[model samples]
Target: MEKITVTAQRKHRDNLPTGSVFGYLPRVVLAAMLASAAVLALIFSEVVRGWEATISAFAISWVVPGQALSLGQVAYFGLGTANPRGIDITELCSAVIIISPLLLLAALLLLMRRFKIGTVFKALAAGFLIIVLANVIRIVMIAFGWDHFGMAGFDAAHQGYGSAFALLAFAAGMIVFIRLSFGRKHKSQQ
Candidate 1:
């Protein structure tokens, strides 16, 4: 049994010839090409399917939190009372759109080991919660804008405040990760 095991090990080592350039560049290139293709396909689909309304719906939904939050914002501000332009802003479809990118970014960072697995995951959870809270705030701001300054103000809040809120969410995630890393380091030193 020992002799047989030795023979098998020798064979395995021999099969992988030294200095044989099994390059990873080709695989990396192929992966990048595929990712680019997928992104292009998604963009094309969105463009072909009425991009304007699709984008607006996506952006609004992400910044509006859940159903109850949205309803409360609308009721409190008295903005979506009669439905503007026959469009109900009650549905929360954009949350998925906004959260998907952040989740993907977090997963990629975790997989790449940019941070510890546990730390990255916890940071991602915190980030998601922050994003939800920010979204609620954004909704309230937009509702108030619409109530006071009409469509122009609503549009401005959607574009400006929504972007700021999203950035805040991202910053929150990074801060969480950094804090966890620092805490871990400090504990190790002690």
Candidate 2:
């Protein structure tokens, strides 16, 4: 009798109520859906571009201190000097290009339900910060190139290795997101 009862108890202990294990599911799903929808809508909006340009303007100004800068808003974001010939921050050149993809990826990771919402958020915050800093650095470098190298410098910095650096930054952010979110579980499982 004792052996039979022990075996039954072990079987029950092995089975977990799925509901209890997934207590955080609702919040995760809601967050993932909201982010995915917003990301899609922002694709056709100038809000992100404007924000990116504004941020870049402030960053570049800080880097080149003392120069009078101008920002063109309403339709698109064009950051230039007082002379009017500045770099136009188009959608393609915007940080949105990289950040969007990562945002989508983070949403998908959230939907997977393997991580807690707080962990996912922390990972995303760190990753986005890295990408933003990299982008600012890229813009600052472009301004530096234009100041010292002229149009040739601008062309090289904007379309050359500068773009490559931005891509690398995105890759780094993705890695950080995955590692931070999943690493916790992987260790516990082992």
Report the poorest 10 consecutive residues by lDDT, candidate 1.
66-75
**Distance from true location, Cα of 7 in model 1, Å:** 38
Please identify model 1 stretches exceeding 4 Å from their true place.
1-93, 112-116, 174-183, 187-190
Model 1, residue 142: distance off in Å is 0.7
The candidate that wins on TM-score is: 2
Give the count of colliding residue pairs in each prediction: 2, 0
The TM-score, computed over Cα atoms with residue i paired to residue i, of candidate 1 is: 0.44
Q: Write the per-residue lDDT of candidate 2 for residues 40-81, one digit (tens) a residue.
A: 636654666666666776766665534434355221112344
Which candidate number maximizes lDDT?
A: 2
**Residue 160 miss distance in model 2 (angstroms):** 1.4
